[model samples]
Target: MVSLIRSALLLAAVASVALVGQASAECETIYVRREVRDLADEEWRVFVEAVQKVMKTEKPQEADGQAMTIYDDLVKQHLDYQDKCHGTPIFLPWHRAFLKTFELELQKAVPGVVAPYWHWGFDSQAPHHSEVLSHKYYGGAGQGEQSCVPDTPFKDYKPTYTADGMPKCICRQYDDNGNRIAPFSPIEELASIVENSPDFDDFSSRIEGNPHGLVHNGIGYGFSSMSSPSDPIFFAHHAFVDMLWAKFQERE
Candidate 1:
């Protein structure tokens, strides 16, 4: 009877292990993120609305003894963790978490709204003409002396938690009289970035230096600043970078 009981217990343990493995395997779910310009009309509307909603919706996060909006919190997270992100080995992973957090916050505003990416590679040759800069989207380079965004859905949107902790309009200063759109990382360069790197270090540096930097610099001053999250395009740009990192991982 004792031997029989021992055999029964062993069988139960094995069964439990098998069940856990099955659950783990089934837990994998793939979410496809579409590019901004490729979103369906309804999807585009929802994405834009969700972004605007998140920027204005206040949450219970700590901020100088005042509640801050989801946008504020997201910006603060990036600004505070700048050390862990820029010019570091953790740049890719750090921004992945940042993008996911931003996505979750956006979904809270509009269920099923996915954070769209800007395929800078597609716009590498002529970024100014990319749908990403259209009036319907994030807007183009700033117009006048102040370099404030001329017009867009977010033209008047203000981010209060900027570098000076004061409200400010989004601005971009494309160098050389609006002619400096940094070509970004072309399609071929993107392919090389993912497939040619010898190790994680090389991959991280190459990505951060090119596609990422090129996009930020191309976007202009406000985006190049530490308070880049102030610009809605910042999320889309990072999303693309995050996607690139994922592709590299898959290749590995």
Candidate 2:
């Protein structure tokens, strides 16, 4: 009886250790080769499969009454956190750490998935801008107008560069100093509320009163802005940002 009890406890201890190992395996920082960027279509499909597998491991949460899966939920949460924390600076690292898990997982699942940076070489060309504007968001820029057209093709085009050297898909109409050419004022319709709402201050204040963060505004470029999801480069830009955040946290 004594031997059996001792053996049972040993098994329980081993099981606990295995569980801990599995939990830690959820995600980690791993690098994918640049060659993965040039993968053939069939190979790319396999890569996607691997990414799906890792996503399965993550088990991202879902929004109520919405069809979003775990991966979608993770991206949504990180985007919201970035919106709130971007200007504050300290939270940048935290948000980046959150992104890294997804990056590593995707890379792990899809071997040789090359994460590419934004290729704005396509941007410096006039014809390229014309091609982009024809899509949707750029149409609002009006040719030769003093409006801001982002480097990326996303909607609500706000151009920004991540501290880690990644160019954000967001393009805004600002001068070289990052000042808005046309300020976005939610208070145009509610001047009274805007003037009195001491609790609200900042670009994303509209998000605070927003029941849904980006969802209500539509995630990733807005409909009036970019008409589709972020370009493939978005993942790489975010991955670099996420890596930066992990490094930043090490110091904190």
Top of the candidates by TM-score: 1
lDDT of 1 by residue, 190-239 (tens): 99989998766788899899678878887778788788998989989989
Give the distance in Å from residue 126's predicted Cα in candidate 1 to where it truly belongs: 1.7
Q: Candidate 1: minimum summed lDDT over ten consecutive residues — where?
A: 1-10
Model 1 spans > 4 angstroms off? 1-25, 28-30, 61-63, 164-167
* Tens digit per residue, CA lDDT, model 2, 164-250: 322343322222222211212122322333334443132124322331122112222221122112223334433433332233223
Worst 10-residue lDDT window, candidate 2: 211-220
Per-model C-alpha RMSD: 10.2, 16.2
Q: Report RMSD for candidate 2.
A: 16.2
lDDT of each: 0.77, 0.34
In angstroms, give how far residue 107 of model 1 lies from its true place: 0.9
